[model samples]
Target: MGTQAIIRPTTSQTAPAQEQNFGDQFLHVFLQDGTPVAKLGCGGSHVLNAAAGQSISNNRWTPITVQYNLPVGKQGGSCMIEIATDNGTAQRLEEYVSHPVSEVT
Candidate 1:
């Protein structure tokens, strides 16, 4: 089985907004019978360089959480994803950051 999600920027002041001129973010996770195999994230013209090699699996209802610490004055941000499998261990996936186009001076 496979799962996918699209992270889009909203106009809300407290939401995670994408930089102007950049495209929406995309995430896809591939699994085999519930075992995670690989995942990827891409947006605009850039793709993440991390590899998803974790042996995380679940057969019941699970809770996944993603957290980001976008520093002030920075043009991009980093995120951490965690998935709670049926084994009771929360697996932390590889972290990824965004690479947006730099503004010309």
Candidate 2:
């Protein structure tokens, strides 16, 4: 199996934040054969996103993309890890990226 991850600047916000907290910012998504296993927060999760800020505005989402691959007969999978945070500036218009990885071991 293999995976790739990337981080970049984005200014897309799909929804408004009502509760401003770390716990409330968490988002989860788990898929098995391209189907949702269960409702979010019901148990273990494969994806969780907590970007932007805590407010009812059009804050950025800071989306993270994770790619994974599974062999035909292999029993394991692979994916990449990502970390995103503000640059300690009033306007989050600055970003740094290390090039995209084509594969993961």
Candidate 3:
């Protein structure tokens, strides 16, 4: 089974909490440390370098998609990410992750 979410960031982005929780998140997306990121199972972290903060942090709704490919046995995991910036620029990434997709996802 799969899951989906729609996030429309309000123009009110304040500093993220010093201790952001990724513990049980399947797809955790946030802008802490001035960088935009999307994390996977067990909240495996990855940078969404496609769009800059100014491009995404507005009242405009930028769409981002993340898909996980679970690991087999001892093999690692991978993810497919796509983002459409509010400005007509499109970004996509398909890469493997250092950690396996945690069931916690």
Candidate 4:
């Protein structure tokens, strides 16, 4: 299967600290057939993301590992990881992200 795909949040316009909230980030994993096999974790980190086409039958409790993919806000900005499931209609997890504060700003 494809090595784990790490996608950083897209930045369209400069946003304020509150605007950087990622309460609806979804990790979409596609199978070899190009069909979205599973929708795991909402935001991105510290959650169990679905492994598409990985021969996983049991849908429950799929092992997942999430890591900080990018730095948000200023240098040491604050961020969050959201878990989404049930056809992207629900949010299951939310966690705060902390890092060294940026020297600038």
Candidate 5:
């Protein structure tokens, strides 16, 4: 059995002020072959892929945590996914970011 965490903005009017127009930004995390994988999307486009051979065991219950630092003026934000098991070190599964872009006139 595997688990997944999907992080995305809610509806436009219902979303928080900071995320209203950025509803198209999303991050997906899931377990594959006992490993954690991630995919990032922005503006309805799949822009980043970090899923690879990162493995975790399915033998015991593990605690997973996701953290994010919201973007600041002209700077990007980042999200980190981690998993920890009893008597083991916490492992970082993935890190996704929303990079800043140049403005076009």
Candidate 6:
């Protein structure tokens, strides 16, 4: 079989305020091939990026399933998937918190 990237299942958790907007959630998976992967869902904090201080909402859930199709390597790219109740809202933060999912191998 051809070489492939072994993606580990990562689950983040957080508790957002009830008053906060638990909009739609999206994920961006960066591959070693310099490609980007995006997925849709819902949760608090909206954007799914690499943060030193961030957590996923345990009460919030998204109905989007993100898939990644890329090779495995030590050198990879970055990704940025925003979240919001409407796509238009997410568009506002797409430029910020760009998450980079690089292969540690």
Total clashing pairs for each candidate: 0, 0, 0, 8, 0, 6
| Candidate number with greatest lDDT | 3
TM for candidate 2 is 0.19
Model 2 misplaced stretches (Cα beyond 4 Å): 1-73, 88-105
Error of 2 at 27 (Å): 13
Q: Name the runs in model 3 displaced over 4 angstroms.
A: 1-4, 14-25, 32-36, 41-54, 77-105
Which of 2 and 4 is ahead in TM-score?
4
lDDT tens readout by residue for model 1, 1-105: 123322232332232212222124444333333333222243344443222333333333332322222211235545434433233454554444455533222
Give the clash count for model 1.
Answer: 0
Tens-digit lDDT track for model 6 on 1-105? 111122332332222211211133333333212212233222223334322112222334322222222222333222233323211123212222223333322
Question: lDDT for model 4, on a 0 to 1 scale?
Answer: 0.30
CA lDDT of 80 in candidate 4? 33
Task: Give the CA lDDT, 0 to 100, for residue 91 in model 1.
Answer: 50
Error of 4 at 84 (Å): 6.0
In model 6, state the lDDT of residue 4: 19
What's model 3's lDDT at 36? Answer: 47
By TM-score, rank the candidates, best first: 3, 5, 1, 4, 6, 2
Cα-based lDDT at residue 36, candidate 1: 37
Looking at model 3, which ten-residue stretch has the lowest summed lDDT? 15-24
Model 4 / residue 7 / CA error / Å: 19
- Candidate 3's residue-wise lDDT over 1-105, tens digit each? 222334455555543211224353344456543334544443345433332234455444444443344333334555554433334443455566565545533
For residues 1-105, write the lDDT of model 2, one tens digit per residue.
111222222244332212111231122322222221111111123232322221211233333222222111122222222222232111111122232322213
Q: Tell me how candidate 3 scores on lDDT.
A: 0.43
Better of 1 and 4 by lDDT: 1
- Per-prediction TM-score to the true structure, in the order listed: 0.36, 0.19, 0.41, 0.24, 0.39, 0.22
TM-score of candidate 4 to 2 decimals: 0.24
lDDT of each: 0.33, 0.23, 0.43, 0.30, 0.39, 0.27
Top-TM-score structure, candidate number: 3
**Candidate closer to the true structure by lDDT (higher is better), 2 or 3:** 3
